[model samples]
Target: MSWKDEIEQLRKRQALAKGMGGPEKLKRQREAGRLNVRERLDLLLDSGSFREVGSITGRAEYDDAGNLIDFTPANCLFGRGKIEGRTIAVVADDFTVRGGAADAAIIEKQIQAEKMAGELRLPLIRLIEGTGGGGSVKSILDMGATYIPFNPGWDQVVANLERVPVVSLLLGPVAGLGAARAVSSHYSVMVKGSSQMFIAGPPVVAGIGEQVTKEELGGADLQLAAGAVDDAYASEADAMAAAKWFLSYLPNSIHDLPERRETTESPGRRDPALGDIVPRDKRYAYDMHQILRSVTDEGSLFEMGRNFGQSVITAFARLDGWPVAVLASNPKVYGGGWTAEAAQKITRFVDLAETFRLPVVHLVDVPGFVIGTRAERAGTLRHGARALSAIYQASVPWCTIVIRKAFGVAGAAMMDHTRFRYRYAWPSGDWGSLPLEGGVEAAFKAALAGADDPDAMKDDLNRQMKSFSSPFKTAERFWAEEIINPAETREKLTEFANLAAPLREPRTKAPRYRP
Candidate 1:
């Protein structure tokens, strides 16, 4: 045969090999309500944007005479792509090749992708399903008795989490290491019904204990409630859309400032409701989110840890097209009291914001840390102390705005230090060691007992204490820098942000954090 004819025949064989599972598996994947790996990458990245890296790599097989098998595209697809016009490293596990299990070349490809992301400072997104690049039983003979060391990919995965925003989407039955990757991400999502994640499959677990389905063990509902995954969606398409939406608020890399969307409203434009959002009555509770929404550019608040810590609300908000981290207390939940869990959440969030060098805007309304026997058993003290330590140690530009009820050490910890930056107070700000209700009961017991009308006397004492507990009263003593009108909040915060813009400090790359 002519050499040209031989080359043509070889190309045909290569094409045939590349079509490994062919149309049948693609149809089956569609029937299962899951997007195939390639489809997932297409949906996640910009159209016509992906530059595939290892498109023609796969299993090494042999014929009956020991001749090599034709080359096949690796069951894994990875390459560079753009999300919202920003470059990112994309890795999608193809379920067609032994469910995308760890093979030598595939492992190397993933490692290379991760390393590139780290070196280039681009964000990484993993579309993981099945066993997530882990070993298969067949591998026992492939390497003899010598075990393959646990993939350094996990370390790189964790390291990327600290340096940049890492996102994962669970589109199918994610088992073993796949579940770990989903949970370790900065943000993770799973498609309901179609997606499930577990440490081990039902058959393996059934050998040791009671039988349970994958969903029962680690369904979307299970992970969302456990805080292992951030959100759950109805479809794989929805999950991809959610991932895109999430990355929009974050920067392309930790070193870069977060991009902003244009708005007609000026940064200094104040929402009139802010003026009276904090009630004059110290005991009254108001929604802090309302105040946050009013002060920030309309539709600019992207809340994080919304479900985990109900007391403290942490969000990325835009003011005059600049990104700032806003931390405020929700008095509606736990009476705006910090619990051990809430403290831990705050500490982690503060560390994240500080690491990214985002300016912090604290809207203080905390009464204090949650108290009582239940709190002590939960190690509230240790966690609260750690939260305080994180806040104090943060070198980022911080501005504290005391809206109302900053009391005790928790309250004090909310204030920006002299070196850190500005501290402002609304006209409604009132801070002390503790609220007077508890103090009145403890200190005025004898006075109330000696009164003719005990109930009326107690009521009178409460009235007297409430009368003096005004933030305006505290402001008279210069306890706060200035008590401003609520309408002045946006202007004040914008001024602070302008001052802080130049105070940003560069951060050195570090390994990912376990938290």
Candidate 2:
């Protein structure tokens, strides 16, 4: 009598929303080895932490009596959630609802999700599937008209990057708007066999006279190689876990500083094997990964974009439990020379770190920007200049460890000399405008040509250059910072973290993040 009938009607609608495209479609979704949107949310967020918004906003049908008859929930579902006990906003596309086509999308719900995250200063995670807000021809026929294409909530999506962290997961065949949203994040991940992202799926591509399968067109492997997404995993659960781990290194928003975790690992822990990690032969490649792991907290290294840039390594790791961005050169690839891809990767990673106010730690081993025909064609110099600009413009606490080879303009970029030079060098440091092997020919070309014994003359000139190449000579002249034993690397970096902690500040608004 006291409006009890209306309350019951609301409950009926809520129940209908939960049904989500009914039994058969859900069964097919499971058969395809994918979890429903709700299930994916549960896996991504902490247990009992989700508070769904707009649960009952969808299409409704009624009889002549105005009694409720049926309801179909909107495809865009979003709400507040927690990951590792930290609050975040999550938006997911329910593919079961009209294949997540535009006809089934609730535009307001998409807008609110991004707005809520930015206004509340919380991270946003998107679980993208199906077409998301992509248009469908059937919807046009239903309306008897068509309109200009526009993304309703795109401004909010772009603005959120400047305020908070945004992560996206591509969990199924994504096209059009879905694909755009997938890469429009600070970090993105895809499930290997379960996900594919493209501008348009195969059926549409065939209309353009090109036939391609989903995997071949935009598979995880191809996207990773193309640097469109940060990483990929074998399963949805793994991808969700990765998203959680990635947020652990950053703060809730750019207005706040990164959080530090308490750890029992000794800051002064030294690994004697580091002394010999680099081989005496300059041509030989050593395991940089091992050195990275050895110097940070026992198990806090999380690498991103591993497949895209083979010459450079970018990762987030902890030094004495304080989060820092780690950049290193891979001696195994192009002798750690920065290629165009590596240069681009550097710009992206450095921007990310600068946006979050994380301190920078660089392990130097670059010979220069990669040279020759391919490098020139790739515009390596332009990209390399952008990377150098990022390094100099960054205001974060900076530290550099000269591990082995640093040469040419790339070598000089190890640290910004204008700032406080928190720099150290290993006994193995070998840096110059150019390595002696190649420079000897250029510098002594005429001398060698006139020598009675050309080969012997070149060898004698190399020995003279080697005498000056010793790191101790640079240290004596106070040009290079202290040259320490490789075993002392961890202790030195841990000290840097402690020193850098006080210098941390919220990112300035001048340079907003670029996806």
Candidate 3:
């Protein structure tokens, strides 16, 4: 064909693809307040910066007369884009095409995208919705007699997860494989009323004896509470905004450290409330989050697992422009006690920060593990041990600030004095193998039993033990490195972060991280 004739044919094809679903569907989507896959890409990426791949790929289907029904790109969209000036790889599913079903070519597209992100060391963001590339009954006919039971691309996906930051956004109904993709991310977000995620849809679930609405079973509230998703938003725009905010703190690749922005805020800036956030009495409880908010850079704390593991707080925050992961005990819940659930949450979080080479700041206020029949039944020992293992395996710089009671195995697990790079205790901090109250009862049982006034004698013994159990006593013994004023915490942490920044040690011969 002549060059002029070819150009006219190409334009006609492009026009037809652009009008695939016609105007009614476009108008309905506009009225419903949800952005389509292409629109979402535009909103997420820098203006005119997205370079699309596989735009002309689609289903290979035939009519009764054997005529082909060619369409635009396949349901999946893969591209390279810039978010807030930082380059990233994006894979978005077009729900308009066969509900974004899994096909051989589309699966190859996803695998290639993941491989590109890993090999190039770029962070990947998946705009997941619909079926999420799961197997369909129609696959039986497509594969004929010789078929592989499992997709090979899953391995690449898993490999990319450990190498770079993976973010997934649930913009619509995510089922089966789709839900897995969402949770497999280092971070995930869901739009409140619009998104629902589940292993199986309501139709499949109904056959198993229970009939429930999608939202009731796998709603944003349910997933957030279960720690399956990191955050939920009221709208798609909010979800995209959050994704941008999250990527701002992470590096584009493992070869580079996260970039820091210049800030007018000083590292020594302190909130007055830190001085008295914790009460002097051991029995009193206070919100550790309040203390964290006061000490870290103002308006910089981005919390993770907020609903699950309520006793502990894990978040990313900036101290004068440097990113650090803050792990604090929330005394408001269970008196800052650690449970099996809390232990699992902490382990996962610490591993993530270590993978990304982020420094850790521990705000210690642990009393002990939650002890009861329920705790024992829940395999608390095994889970708590996992948390300890993760902390021990961490290679990144760690610093702990003992805010209050740091007692028993839980305290030791928070930040081991022997292994941690830097450790500081506040004046009000207290540390022991066990709290003095329980120890006094166990050690002075005989003495109190023989006394004329057992109650009075027990009270006296408790007071005596409390006096020697103060944080200053530990400082005197050189168990705690130094005791600092509450106001100096931000400055001290920032100095330590700078000191630790230059201390980089790569894993030379270590085995792959498990769990």
Query: lDDT winner among the candidates?
Result: 2
Query: By TM-score, who's the top model here?
Result: 2
**Per-model C-alpha RMSD:** 3.3, 1.2, 2.7
Residue 212, candidate 3: how far off, in angstroms?
0.4
Tell me the lDDT of model 2 at 281: 94
For residues 277-318, could you state the per-residue lDDT of candidate 1 as single tens digits? Answer: 777676779989998988887887877657676788888888
lDDT for model 2 comes to: 0.91
**For each candidate, what is the lDDT?**
0.78, 0.91, 0.80
Question: Between 2 and 3, whose lDDT is larger?
Answer: 2
Clashing pairs in 3: 57-74
- After superposing candidate 1, which stretches have Cα over 4 Å from the reference? 1-24, 62-73, 103-105, 141-149, 279-284, 416-421, 444-460, 509-512
Error of 2 at 368 (Å): 1.0
Residue 396 local lDDT, model 2: 92
Tell me the tens digit of each residue's lDDT in model 3 across 274-393.
778788877889877777777777788888778888889999988777888889999888888898889988988998878777889999889889999999998888999989988988
lDDT string for model 2 (264-344, tens) is 999999999999899999999998999999999988999999999889999999999999999999999998999999999
Candidate with the larger TM-score of 2 and 3: 2
User: Per model, how many backbone clashes are there?
Assistant: 1, 0, 1
Q: Positional deviation of 447 in candidate 1, in angstroms? A: 6.0
Total residue pair clashes for candidate 2: 0
